[model samples]
Target: MSTYLIGDIHGCYDELQAILEQVNFDSFMDTLWLTGDLVARGPRSLEVLRLIRKLGDSVRIVLGNHDLHLLAVYAGIVRNQLKDSTTLLLEAPDADDLMNWLRCQPVLQVDNQNKMVMAHAGITPQWNIDTALQCAREVEAVLRSDSYPILLNTMYEDMPNHHHWSEELSGLARLRFSTNVFTRMRYCFPNGQLDMICKDMPNKAPEPLRPWFTLPSLIAENYSIIFGHWASILGNATPEGIYGLDTGCCWGGELTLLCWEDKKFIRIPYAGIKHW
Candidate 1:
């Protein structure tokens, strides 16, 4: 049996199907790991979510920022942004189930035997793999709790770019920063300040903000990190021991699939859009 890691699907069901065909994915013999953002910014969000849910234990999905946002919106804690693109998802008959599944997903996953970790965004330079998993669990607990709706109400806005963790950051508000740092984060100010605003390449961020992967004395040097959500920058390439899978399938780029154990990659070019 082989494990495959797929990049940000972003609701592109057709592309996902095409890539799965390329890999010859088998439900019984193969397992799929998704880097998150399984829905959003594309046409078939419902279809993709349903397909993944149908896959059940055959798949492991680490939550992405978009997934969290969808949960917030579904719970009525947050309003829809980006031109009501998620409206259809909210109106779906299985919306609650989909939202529940998304909220239950962890922000980080580790395969100790393989010395590998997967998250939607990259890990913080300051955090070792164990600490990152611990932090993700703390948030995951809140997301899974009865207070989740209350937490979602507070999930908006960027938190302070400081590196220190605070216990006072309960529920969704606490998650906002963590999610951004681990999922959407790219660059940061030298002193461990998060540069959440800039989405461009690492070189383009201000001098104070360096890409998280470039920080001095990174902790996860011994393990390989797999992540998506940097489609605009890394595309479907593996850099060093870090794997970036988001090929911007929803934005007219390729959909990427990587075989985790063997490091084999398959990319399906976008016949729909040209650029993300």
Candidate 2:
């Protein structure tokens, strides 16, 4: 059975289907790993969620920033934006089941046998694999618990901005930092502090800032890391063992799927569907 790692879909259901077909993905045989942002921006958010949810055990997903935002909007903790295409998903008859399924998803997935780790964004440089796993479980517990709305309500702010992880960090502050690292981080200072403002490609980014993967980390030294979120990179080559899969399919680029056994990338260009 082949294992395929797909970049962010962002609600581009048609493109997702096309790429899966192109790869001859078999739900019963091949395993599909998604880099989240499963809904938003593009058309048919509802359909995309439904299809992935139906895939069940064959699919593995880590929640993206957009997926969290969609949950917040569904929980009435935040308002849906005009540019977002998730309203249909929020209003769907199976919205509750879908949201619950999403809430139960983790922020980090590790395949020890393959020595690979997947997160929506890259793992923080400050944390080792064990620490990252612990932090992910911390957030996942809250998300799967009755207190999930509390996290959804308080996680929107970027606190301790541009700061590194601290042992002293506790309560919601700690959870928020972990959440950002797993789902929103892009650039970080050489000292391992996060820099949330810059989204430019590495060369264009101002001095003292480097992509998170460039920073020294125990995790990177070991497992191969697969992530999405930074669509601006357009699937450009990154440091060895680091994979950036988001190719901006929702913004008129291609949807990318990495074939794990052979490390082949199968791309399906956007069909130019108008933004919702």
* Top candidate by TM-score: 2
C-alpha lDDT of residue 258 in model 1: 90
Q: Candidate 1: minimum summed lDDT over ten consecutive residues — where?
A: 161-170
Using all chains and alpha carbons, the TM-scores for the candidates as numbered come to 0.90, 0.96
In order, candidate lDDTs are 0.77, 0.90
Summarize candidate 2's per-residue lDDT along 1-276 as a digit string, tens digits. Answer: 999999999999999999999999999999999998999998888999999989989998999999999989988899999788777888889999999999999999999988899999989888888999999999999999989999888777765552568878888888888888888999898888888788888999999999988778878467899999999888675888889999999999999999999999999999966563
7-41, model 1: which lDDT tens digit per residue?
A: 99888888889989888899899989999988888
How accurate locally is residue 69 in candidate 1, as Cα lDDT from 0 to 100? 77
Q: Mark the regions of model 1 whose C-alpha exceeds 4 Å error after superposition.
A: 81-84, 159-176, 217-220, 236-239, 273-276
Candidate 2 whole-model C-alpha lDDT, 0 to 1: 0.90
Which residues of candidate 2, in runs, are more than 4 Å off?
Answer: 220-222
Q: Clash number for every model?
A: 1, 0
In model 1, the clashing pairs are: 252-273
